[model samples]
Target: MRKLLSILMILLSIQAFAQDDKSKDRIDYSGEYNGTFTDIKDAEGTMQLFLYQPDKGRTSGIILLTRIVNGKSEVTTGTINIEGNGEFISGNFMPSEIKYIAPREDEDGIMQNTYDSYSCRWEIFGQITDKKGNTIIGKAVPANCVESNLIEFRINKKK
Candidate 1:
């Protein structure tokens, strides 16, 4: 009975240490990331993202994108919050809310078709890669806009 009890205690101790080490092995994903997306027309756009994780399971960031519309360039910026699971090596991303920044008139008056208010709800689904610089591959869409096309994007972390 004494030997059996000792073995059980040793097993428990090993389990506890394993759990502790697992947490420490989680990847840190706080940095600037740049990505590109191809629209339905096959035109490519650029994405600049600043991401940080405040706590386990919660990742938040500011994102900016520039795309061509009707031969003109349009820029949009927003805030994104998502629930994260998996290490920085690879994982799932669940968006909580993605809201565009309040709009403003074209200050220079050189831009066309600009709006005073830009509203959008974005949904992004994808995974983080384990490759060099940890590339990100995903699909992004304007979830509330029916006319918007889905964009497939790949991003890499900046050094």
Candidate 2:
């Protein structure tokens, strides 16, 4: 009877330890977020973010942009940083430096779409309120070359 009690006690303790370790594991931030930059003119789009654990003890993700450029699809994808316990999360996605299109008035004073290139990017860093919550990133540059550091976008995890 004493031996049986000792084994049961050890099993219980091990179970408790396992639960404790699971709680300390990183909170899952993988999901799709829809948002719009409130501070930029004519800025409206959807941001799909996919996060995964690249290896032991680290995290990374990709940011997919749609309709942020003149109705053309552009994307920014890369790593982002999340603060302790997922209370705060932060990351930046820079679109590859490549030649894209630009629209402007030609010498004839008529609107036209021309090809040009610039370093376009969008960054997200803010508090998550909770494991499943809303967040506001302070700055987001649209797919175009127009740089606006004062731009801010409110993101909500889709239900």
What does the lDDT read for residue 142 in candidate 1? 60
RMSD of each: 7.5, 7.3
lDDT tens digits, residue span 51-137, model 1: 887654467778777788679987778777655555233222323333434445575855343222223566777677773326778
After superposition on all CA atoms, how large is the RMSD of candidate 2? 7.3
Name model 2 segments beyond 4 Å from true. 1-22, 54-57, 68-84, 100-118, 133-138, 141-146
lDDT tens string, model 2, 46-137?
Answer: 65556564332344666655545766765544445443345665566665454456678989999765542224555556676555544545
Q: Evaluate residue 131 in candidate 1 and report its C-alpha lDDT on the 0 to 100 scale.
A: 32
What TM-score does candidate 2 get on C-alpha atoms? 0.53
Q: What is the lDDT of candidate 2?
A: 0.56
Q: TM-scores of the models, in the given order?
A: 0.65, 0.53
Against the unseen true structure, what C-alpha lDDT does each candidate score?
A: 0.67, 0.56
